[model samples]
Target: MISACGRDNVGSKNTAQASHSSADAATRTIQTVKGKVQIPAHPKRILTDYYAGELLSVGGHVIGAAPLEFTNPFLKDKLKGAVDVGDPINVEKALALKPDLIVTDSDKNYDQLCKIAPTLYIPYGTAHNIDETVHLFSRIVGQTKPGERLLAEYREKAAAGRKALKGVVAPGATAGLYEITDKGDLWVFGPNWGRGGQAIYNALKFKLPPKLAASNKQYLQLSLEALPQYAADYMFLTSYDPEHKGTALKNLRQSPVWKDLPAVKEHRVFYNDFNTFYPYDPISITKQIDLFVDMLKQNAKENKPGQGQGR
Candidate 1:
């Protein structure tokens, strides 16, 4: 793992070494749609659970993130004195902090978290949506208007970014989101109903394979033997770590059928940020789009004019 306190960790976790942070008695009170939540006006000893990304976007540093709760390289480096608070549902460690305020989505065990601190539930999309999440979280932090503005800027950027990639992407290129497991299980993402695949398709308006229309909200199983049938113009290889430097990728490459797919043969497979692709949020979605554009642009450089695709 990358050093958690290095300059590269964009999301800083140095709660103990915070330039400015206060204890519960010195915190400020924030009023929100849910209710008033008293926070250490400028808490130095903050604890985060499920919504670390949400908090990071709103300038909130985490003293804790769940063990499995992944953070990017930027966040990993800055989290000094940070503790792995366990998963969002783990009430035991969460209660020990006696945190002034806890931020999370509604899907978590709110009742238990509430007992530990003045918990704030913003729902799943709030952390995912560009504006809604920032606005809601900023309000919880007692700085609503700024959060609103930031979200607006993000939307503007997202729109501009999408428009920039429109013409560059080829038309009618069917795409699929592949969920690969350590156990060799394969799950294909369906149409744009919900989930990361939907979020990705929604932002860029990418086309889906016809067979995926009825495959919403569920994983479509594919054995190694049947990998070729589901191959599309482009396969968004997700849920794997590229940093492992050929760890999972090496395993996938060794699959006999996986190595023989048309997309693989054509070198049309691209790795995606696994963290966001599994269960997505707007920030993750936008980030993924940006990545897609980067990869697409790279692909364009090598392909003949008529070889590109989109849908």
Candidate 2:
């Protein structure tokens, strides 16, 4: 009968090296939403439940993240080896990656995640805006310098965009962002939420309807029949099945209430996929500014005043 081999001689060098690496690995302590915790000085494999895009912009080595981060086209190329661990995050899948650090926006399974690696808890709406979020993530990854550079670049682009779009788009033009879920739920995004709201309202300086702006809320749920009550100059309707002939879109169109809106009547509405501009991360925001400028410019050129999408 064979006996189990011991660690006396088999791959001794590798074992020694691994022990040395563990013992010599540098660490740093920082205050997190869950209190202070020490982590690797430079994390190599990070799995996050949300805001994965913020870390990616600062040259983070993300190994796994949630499904939303993987779906954004702007971030897809940067996430080469990353997989979606799950929205709430599957601890088993997270452990399989052997992540050096884990960041999550929820407290569910916090203890379980800590067993796999040094975990940092960051709740949703922790930062007031995307710029603050970039600063937050950069500090978390010890990438503050690069984060500063990215913010400067984003601001510079917005400045140039503001000048280029001068007198092109209608002044005081309000753009309303809406979403139709697979379940036919209608949502209006506030300034802080993603789905291109930050790009359109903050970076581009567009206005929301007076009522939506006054409410100061994250999202406003509205029935299809109530849509006409808060119409704007332009509308961006993001849906789960943007390209396909989805039931939500069909149902919305069938309602005479939708057809009577001024923005709809003038064809100043765009139907976009949910993932198209879902990520409001700094990197995505930078790219989105360029897309918004072009889209608004094209809308102005294509439609005559009070004719097509936007006057």
Candidate 3:
């Protein structure tokens, strides 16, 4: 009886070891900002601190994400099953979800996150632009083929929009983006900043006027009076209204300085809602291309006679 019992115990131990080995084999290694991490090759649940839209675009299954990420219009429907883990991620909830892979923009709580699962840390701005952002996420999810398809589609849309915008954004006809804060401060944006820059500078390929082009800043602080100094022929404006009613935007419209600008005088100024172009994702950027093209087409110099005839 003792010999029979010993044989059964050994068989059970061998089966457990085989199962553990199989589980280990199912995982694959990938390099992140924190170095190499072995993650499930087909992760069943993915949790991201930010860029949920970027992940979803590559067809990755997201289970937990940042609260604001849930609000992205471009990713709204696709994130139906995702959990909003609050402003700072709710680590307890993340663990409860049993996410096989965790991805975050910052290294904050990385040790904690890793305790829950294999965490992939990606520092913000790791990808210089939206296309690279898409490709990077695709590689992270092991969906490179789908990522290539999505990128090609984006390029096709961008190409079509850029072709249509060629005549509108003629030589010397520049586009500059600016924002008015609830505190009544005025700010200007460069080609790489999040505010419609992807569409204006990247997609439409507008001619940046001399004054606005020479400044080396991505975005800058300037007084309301200095608006014209940095203003382009086509002005794109947005208002920052986090804690107040939209009185600053109203006041800017009422101000003589705003009304006196050439872009305003010629009806070349376009006001964008803060949420529309604020998301710096490929999906949101693609939507922005259409929005920008429509605005330019409706107000294109040639479309309106005597508007820019002399220029």
Candidate 4:
């Protein structure tokens, strides 16, 4: 009887040891843009200085964020309860949140955030390809399957957008995308910039004018004098400041150079809202594709081929 009791006790001890070992293996060491970070098996309270849109797209939990007014406008309502840590992020406020993990693209506040928690700094423009951003976010949160599913969904939507605009826009048709600041600065974007370039140039395969196509920079700041050189068959124009009340657009319309542009003369310019069309994340991309297809259809109906000077 004594021997049997000793055997039972040994079996229980081994089982408990095995369980503890499994739990330890669950936690992993991951390599981030900044360096290596050991994260919990499941992080509940996550703080993101930026890339909130990308996190939300993949269904990651974001308990805290900074610059909420700017990056998360599309899903602001959903993040109503999230703690706004301030633009540049307040270290005191962030620590008070007691986050499990903190993610950011800026290194300015990296040391401060690291002291508060296990912070991961993802370099700026690392995810210019959108798919890379989604995959990276998924791997960080241990949601690889969901990330793949979300990417598939985005691909399907992009394909559908191309099909929808097939009859509306002819092959080889060129387009120019530009944004004007309240201070009267003109900005043009390239294929990887946030201004619907992925959807316009990559997905829909629109051509850029020769002058604008020369450089590979995400965006170029140009003067009013140079605007005529970037003219194309169609134009997508927007203003950054919502309260500026069309002052920039008004000024551009007054310019003789702008009026003489082929897109303007043919009335093929589509004025877009900054908030809806500027972001390059999964959510914004979906909306941009739909809006772009509709705009092309409308332009095709109103203006036929050879109606514009360039055509």
Off by over 4 Å in 2: 1-25, 242-245, 305-311
Whole-structure CA lDDT of model 2: 0.76
Name the best candidate (by lDDT).
2
Score candidate 4 by lDDT.
0.72
Give the Å error, residue 241, model 4: 1.5
Worst 10 residues of 4 by lDDT: 11-20
- State the lDDT of candidate 2 residue by residue for 1-311, as single tens digits: 01111112232121001111243457655465455556667888889987688888876788898887877888888887788899788989997999888878888988788888877777667776768777677766766677888888889988888877898877788989888887899988877788888788888888998778888887899988777766688898888664465888789867888888877787788776577677778888888888888877887778786566532
TM-score of model 2 (CA atoms) = 0.86
Q: CA lDDT of 30 in candidate 1? A: 46
lDDT agreement of model 1 with the native: 0.58
Cα TM-score of candidate 3 = 0.83
State the weakest 10-residue window (summed lDDT) of model 3.
Answer: 11-20
What lDDT would each prediction earn against the true structure?
Answer: 0.58, 0.76, 0.73, 0.72
- Give the CA lDDT, 0 to 100, for residue 74 in model 1: 32
- Candidate 3, superposed: residue stretches over 4 Å from native: 1-25, 301-311
The candidate maximizing TM-score is 2
Comparing 2 and 4 by TM-score, which wins?
Answer: 2
Which pairs clash inside model 2? Answer: 268-309
Model 4 residue 291 lDDT? 78
Give the per-residue lDDT digits (tens) of candidate 1, residues 30-124: 43334434555554445666566556666666667766455553345556566787765467877676566676654367666766666555544
lDDT of each residue in 170-231, candidate 4, tens digit only: 88999888999987899988767777887788778899877878875678898999988887
